[model samples]
Target: MKILTIVPAHNEESTLDSCINGIRNQTIETDILVVCDNCTDNTEQLAKSLEVNTLKTINNVHKKSGALNQALDKYLLDYDLILVQDADTIIDNRLLENAVKEINKDTKLGAVCSKAGIKDIMSSK
Candidate 1:
């Protein structure tokens, strides 16, 4: 199945790289697209440097939803599944692999979502 992961981001320069890397390292390979939502930071450049696809929102006023809508409008028909991932999140490597398994196991499955967790950045410091 063709899977595309859409990441909606603004000025997320601090967290975007990790999120992109986490998506790239997933057990199930997926195409990543970073929606640069009227960002005034290095988000677009960073995504480009990471070698992932990017879509810059033009005068988006609806924030996250609008960014997603733009990307969805362009990609909704191209892939079998589209994962809307948060820009600040670093997902587990097995997330896509496991999600795909569950989706395939049940034909009625509408969507698969993961539990969120807070990383101990203070402890690392």
Candidate 2:
């Protein structure tokens, strides 16, 4: 199954590389789409440097969700499934494999999500 992962980023220079690496290291083959939303930093450049499919968002008041929906509405409808990921989060390499396995086993599965143990969630809040 072809999985297309969309990463919504907004000035995520510090954590973007880690996130990208996490995706790249996934066990299953995946097409990654990184949406840079109103990024004033080097987020676009970083994604471009990696030579991954990248898109920039326009009219992004809703932030990450808006950027994500832009890709969802426009390009990337050929994949079997879509993974919504945050720019700063580093997901496990086994995430795609595990999620796909579970989803495939249960045909009625609408969505599969894993827990993100963000170390600074409290500090950010």
lDDT of each candidate versus the true structure: 0.92, 0.87
**Clash count in backbone of candidate 1:** 0
* Per-residue accuracy of model 2 over 1-125 as CA lDDT, tens digit each: 88898999999888888888999999998888999999999999999998889999988899877898899998666888988888888788899999898888887888888976757633674
- Model 2 C-alpha RMSD to native: 3.5
Residue-wise C-alpha lDDT for candidate 1, range 51-90, written one tens digit per residue: 9999999888999999999999999999998889999998
RMSD of candidates 1 onward, in order: 1.2, 3.5
Q: What are the runs in model 2 whose C-alpha is more than 4 Å off?
A: 119-125
- Where is model 1 poorest over a 10-residue stretch in terms of lDDT? 116-125
Candidate 2 is scored at a TM of: 0.89
| Clashing pairs for predicted structure model 2, backbone only | none
Note the residue pairs that clash in candidate 1.
Answer: none
